[model samples]
Target chain A: MSVRFWRVRALAMLLALFVGGCTAPPLLTAVLGPPLKPLPVAGRLRRPVYKPYHEETMTYNLVPPPKADWHAKLKALPLTAAGGTDWVKALNENLIKPKPGLDAKAEDEPVMDLDVVLTPKDAPDFKVTYPHKPHTQILSCDNCHTGIFQMQAGADPITMEKIFAGEYCGRCHGPVAFDPASACPRCHTAMPQ
Target chain B: MRQAALWLALLVLATLLPAAQVSAEQGDIVFTRSSKEEGADYPPATFPHYVHRMQFKCYVCHDAIFKMKAGADKVSMDAIDKGKFCGTCHNATIAFGPTFESCQRCHK
Candidate 1:
């Protein structure tokens, strides 16, 4: 047999020892693998090439902020019922000062929660029945919580301004999750003029 | 002398041919399943040969059960008894190496 065959077979056999008593085929050996670079003494497993980061959709379960309520929805109720606070005051107190919490989070995992909303927009008071469970099965929580909104209960103000600016719900409803180029009425329709 | 030269040329061809093959090697194994009983229906992990090679050394899985050729890899519980198949390492680090548990693990 050829000496090259012997050498390749020997090398493959040595490598196979690392896994089990299995031998590798000489044919699989690299013919002229870049120069005979020395395997790192300690970091032998280091890869010679770098791989780029790939992006994918992340999902997270969303629950209505419990401790605090959306001031827009609340304020729309009645001057007295919404604590008789102005829009700015409500934003500063409810949405801005106290942030929202995620309640829970994990790598590649979705947060789940049953939603209960009391909105006074064009509809009556009722729970949103947000698909928290179903959504959790598909999304990552990081996909939702942003620097604009704290990872808590009442951080994201859920404002028409920020939402249209592609902030809170706008992040996905338009760009991240859906197309945002359409007419503005899709999201702003419910807002009081 | 002519015969000796011919053998030498053949030897060179064998060595040179592998180099040629290596240059042509765009080593990435693509896995696609069209069978209604595969992937979604079957979760056997289609076993990406190239992908596995990307992150691992040949020794990680050359095991006695697998050979160079595709069908040549004799993967069976019977061979596993002799420390073949996944049982080779499954015994040391992967799990009980290849026991009653392993037979059912892979076959099932």
Candidate 2:
């Protein structure tokens, strides 16, 4: 065989080894079977609380032992009158002890509220009220200052398109903060007819 | 044959550079102090390292404000109020103070 042929064969084998090493596990699982035990009948049961047949129901009790109840105990504590789960209140009451000077100020305390009216030229009807007080309560001025919005007014070219695309207000609104879709009145309080 | 091997090595290095750059640019890191103590009155404090990193460099707290090792520094609310831990920056003037209302911001 020519030297060129031997070189090509060696290269092909090396490439095959690399690719096979990367993809072997999934391929092996498909050929054989997953090493995991069959899921419990309770897990396999369909939603809407349907009762399974004798064979299906037999494995229901075979489900893994319950996890520690510490999470449940924490959830049971009454933190707020609102009834829904408030992780902050739970953490405060159960986990976090009040430290001197770390106490949050009263809501009625004299705090500056910079409620800016954002009226886009394209959509003059929808005016967004940018509430600064609530945001400033948790975030530093530099969080948004200079990075997202300039300190000067009329400097930020904020558009709905840019916001939806995860720019400007979209940073917190869509993900961890608030639901941007349904929470219209939260921002757009002033709607022109 | 030698030329082919050289080209392969160059290709591998080229792929690694962009991946390294992406991770460096991401900069977002969440620090949780759950390991030190569990089931406290509050959830473990979750420090948004990325949020701070955007304005400040890593060295600002890596060794100066906070120790490099996890669970090394004992941080309390009192410590923060005395301008020790988070209070150094979150003193209302520099950043939002560690007030009662702002407890959830970090506790979560």
Candidate 3:
């Protein structure tokens, strides 16, 4: 045979092997029609036909079981009534307890409540009252202080658009922390005059 | 000769591209061992495998802390408290400890 003929034959063989190996049975079935049905059994077999275990129907209930109000527990403590000593001071007085291991001086030092008003010029009606005291209970100051919000006031250019896009406060507030959308009144406390 | 070299390079690239794409996209695998086990106190632990994969490689836990096969690892509260399985990471300093307060974080 000529060298050219031998080369063409070898190339054809390679292509055939590649195509055969790459073509899955399911893909071929999809392209063509459904595969031929299995031969019908005349009588019942010794063992029963396999049925996949349905986890939803079959699984045992949890022993103690999860609380129905589990998601509700994530909500922030309700705000104190409007006509009272500063909300922060009232919240601190109710919740803050002395750390057992801390020194006498450290124990005596009151829980720092740095409440700030966030009033964007665009949204004159809505003012965000950021109560730092509650967050301090769960998270260390550095968690948000330097990383998200600057220590100095008005340093970070926080906007509603940025928060919704999962920047700054949105990082934890939306997913891990409180539900930002539902808990609007929790943050936006200032009543429009 | 240059044409043959280009064809060879293209063949190699075609073979590697699919594998690279598969490894890049790792989906979340939720573990529901509580359903199988008898007398589970809480709901099944929803393990966000994708979340951990972001920080560390697959080999960090697979075949070391946990077996490659599913349902192979016999995880228990006692085992975790002794810093055996999940306790290795959930030792307070590394991650939240498997204490009473943090139960809902995973159990739900």
Candidate 4:
């Protein structure tokens, strides 16, 4: 064989090893538990490298955990770890407290206990039960009231198109809270057969 | 003697400068002067500066919507109902309206 052919063969072997190293981890780990110790190559023909699955990547944030046991604290809360963070749940559970103002001692307005049930004319199955408890817990009544929604039921024409466009519920849903685009059951809890 | 006079002028300007500039840290403001008889009888609306500041930036209400000075803006129930001053937001839509039932929410 020519010198060029020998060089190409060596390069192909290196490429094969690189690809095998990247793809062989999960298959190897399943068959055998994580590698216990590094292999010592005294007279080995080829060396094999094993990659360990990083447990840290599964954590919510890459930032270092606080000195306190935050794992226990977060685990206690009703957070949708698989889904996005449900801020409303955190507020409801008192896991996180929002001050009415900059003053740590400032009093917040009383929570208005009201639930508006909206049965969209088009899709009554996806009836939306808009709870005031979560909203009034942090925001003042004036925040929405007659501006975005009227006090009377069936007053405002709410549509999915409008919400996705960043109007009405879309104003805060996508920007601040869990995205409504992905999470439909959050609002449309009244699904009937 | 000239230096003393100049110092007096400077002192007066210092006090008056803030009135014009409108400090954001002027905590709560109570509206008292009302032209209507019913307005005078009702408790003055206590505007919680800290509460609003948390929700909105200073520019949301300052200078354009409301003059920063205490007495600069003549805020009354009528003016508010007409969509001026507090009425701009408190029109039973944006914020809680300055309604008959909601008088205590702010006045308190």
Candidate 5:
């Protein structure tokens, strides 16, 4: 065959491959007639399918690696029996220092030393002692009082069901602070004899 | 000569632009309306503009909550307790209310 005929054959093959792959059915059908069923390839004729570019995944090098003695100070800080960071214990021991407000320049807010004893009507046995000292240390009075809870005792009905539903104490307790589900004895100090 | 004058005008405008932006950063507002006339029991309430600015945006309290002009809106302890003026946020619900216990918080 002539070079011109070979060139035309190659061009037709390329066009057929493109039309078969593309979703332009109108053009494909008009040029090549109705679509023909694909023929099955035998074992030897089949080619293995794979991505062309298979280089190893790149490492995130933007963030600098920690020092050799990294986490040494963190390990030195107080930890619970379960091997978790004891936040309250660490705060008391001066292991960690947390600012009450976001702004460093702002003056330290006062901590209400009052402790509220909550006796749920449903579960009278499990009495909860809500200590304002720890809460007020980080948050303002308005953060809870009148918003999440009422200042007056018995005004707000606090139940475990409500707390688990992310209401009242559950707002910070479950999401940010310790999960109340696991730490039951933490809040419920007064157990029935 | 005209180009030189235009350049000088542009330089002046550039300097004034920064000053105009910094004007929004107002100092702490000391409310004296309650304690000014009479020798009141408590001192004037000092509203920390910088502290509130850190938490909220300008539009949160400006125009809608409080007028921009000084002493334009009447602020009284009674009104505050009733959830008006400063009471809107300081009603013990939103923020620490202006109660007898928390007097020094704002008064200072």
Candidate 6:
């Protein structure tokens, strides 16, 4: 065929292919970008073109479990996982044996102290200085009360053993939230300041 | 004769229909259960009309929390604790979940 005639035919064919959504046959190798590679699994590929089910297009901020003390802001707190890490033992240790200073008695008001009630049932009427304003200022409500504190105050029946397990103060002081050892006496003061 | 019979049936049906049929087939959400048993009468503490209107859109609790249309959301105490139905908000913020046992707050 003549050069001019051949060119016209090729142009028309290209136009038809474009309209039909048809492209040049696949080459043994890719013309532009690198050849597609197999993807990871878990990580499964439902699509033929290796479109990943969980390609993890973006990184997400991992929410390290919920803090406990922020919970007490509520009128009452519950006694479940929400119960400030539900670690009464660790909490007792921190409160009674806090870092050298930052002691519970550091606060002026007795009612505002971070001292523990120890036994809610035995000392039902024995309300102690909670030192709430200072703590709340520094931490979220769950820091002391545990996640469940929003439901009730004397809620967890908080015990030293429980606090150690990371229920009350342990929720933060233990490992994830805060290092109970950082200043054991700071929160768990041996004596009132 | 057939037409007459059909007409009679229609009239009877119309009369049988109660006036002002309740839109909420499920009725208003009530916390109390039928039994007087100590733990019986509380069903996740109903989500009142006022509360729903105040906190969120009809869209959120509708299809997601409850099926669209009125009186369709089935909020169970166990489910709320598991973070379903009312649990979506209650566990997160609105209120505590069933897992937390603050008897007076919910039961009362």
| Model 5 lDDT tens row, A1-193 | 3566767666655654454445344444555566553332222312122212213631212222233331454457666654445656766676556544424465656767988888877777688888888766556665566667887877877777888887888765654456777667777886532
Q: Score the docking of each candidate (DockQ).
A: 0.01, 0.04, 0.05, 0.01, 0.01, 0.01
Instruction: Estimate every model's Cα lDDT from 0 to 1.
Output: 0.36, 0.52, 0.52, 0.59, 0.57, 0.39
lDDT of 6 by residue, A32-119 (tens): 3444432322322222222122237411112223434422322132222333322233323332122211233343212234543433
Prediction RMSDs, each to the true structure? 27.1, 18.8, 19.1, 28.9, 29.2, 28.9
Clashing pairs in 4: A142-B94, A142-B95, A142-B96, A146-B93, A147-B93
lDDT of 5 by residue, B28-92 (tens): 56788554433364456777654553344333555556755457788876677666788788754
Among these predicted structures, which one has the highest lDDT?
A: 4
Give the CA lDDT, 0 to 100, for residue A164 in model 2. 80
Task: Quote the positional error of residue B89 for candidate 1 in Å.
Answer: 29
Q: Residue A64 lDDT in model 1? A: 15
Report the lDDT tens digits of candidate 4 across residue range A1-193: 3576767656655664555455455545555556453232233222122111235573312332234433344345464533655556766666655556434456777787888898988778889989898777766666676667788888888888999886788756664456777777778987531
Ten contiguous residues minimizing lDDT sum, candidate 4 chain A? A44-53
Each candidate's number of clashing pairs is 16, 11, 0, 5, 0, 65
lDDT tens digits, residue span B63-101, model 3:
457653345688866677778877777655455566444
> Chain A TM-score per candidate?
0.29, 0.44, 0.43, 0.57, 0.56, 0.29
Instruction: Give candidate 6 misplaced runs (Cα > 4 Å).
Output: A1-193, B1-28, B31-38, B41-44, B68-71, B92-95, B99-106
What TM-score does the first chain of candidate 1 have? Answer: 0.29
Cα deviation of B98 in candidate 4 (Å)?
37
Worst 10 residues of 5 chain A by lDDT: A45-54
Ranking by TM-score: 4, 5, 3, 2, 6, 1
Q: Give per-residue CA lDDT, model 1, range A54-141, as digits (tens).
A: 2132111122113222323433422322122232333324432221221223222434765434243555332122334433333334
- Candidate 3 lDDT at B88 equals 76
Candidate 3, position B32, lDDT: 59
- Which candidate gets the maximum DockQ versus the true structure? 3
